[model samples]
Target: MELKELLDIERQGWDALCASTGASFYGELMTDDAVMILANGMVLDRAGVVESLRDAPPWRAYEIDDPRLVDVGSDSKVLVYTGIAYRDGAEPAFRGIMSSTYVLTKAGWRLACYQQTQISQ
Candidate 1:
């Protein structure tokens, strides 16, 4: 898939997270064996992620900024970007850079890995 399309998927994933959609919906764009490295340095596998996010608090807004694509191979690509997270009646919750790896499978583009690094003021 083109970089723009991949970026759109990334944005949609962020939207889904912020909306606190059910785990099943959140898992649709991800690989069954996907993993995520949280800003707190916690590593979570697909099941861990789904479980944790199943009851996550809703966010007021989530904006991904300056996404750039890195083609890894014929079947894989990586997206690097910064993002801002907003919550109702609270200060911005997260200012961070994120990297997500997408791999083409029989089901099309699916997120294989994701990592986030918080930016301190």
Candidate 2:
């Protein structure tokens, strides 16, 4: 697939995985060395992130808005956007804005790193 197509696929996978609240799908999309910086200031590796989410509350709903894609060439790109995630019985959590960088590898575009910051707006 072309670079843009690959990114689209990745975006779809991301949304689906979030909607499913399934760690396995998230695990599949992450590289072995992927790093995630959570809004709570926790830095987790691939396994750590997946394992933590496994026990977390299910995502009752989610919306990814205004996905902006930046091509870094050679099959690498960065996706920055704002998203809101709502869990059952909890108020909607607005992620404010976040950025996830993906690298195109033989295994397709695996997420390299993700950082999320809570927005007050």
Maximum-TM-score candidate: 1
Question: Which 10 successive residues of model 2 have the least lDDT summed?
Answer: 1-10
Off by over 4 Å in 2: 1-21
Candidate 1, pairs of clashing residues:
none
lDDT, candidates in the order shown: 0.84, 0.74
Over 1-121, each residue of candidate 1 has an lDDT whose tens digit, in order, gives: 4779888887777777777883765577778888999999899888988888888887788888898899899999999999888878867888899999999988888999999999973
| Residue 64 lDDT, candidate 1, scale 0-100 | 83
| Native-structure RMSD, model 2 | 2.6
lDDT measured at residue 76 in model 1 versus the true structure, 0 to 100: 94
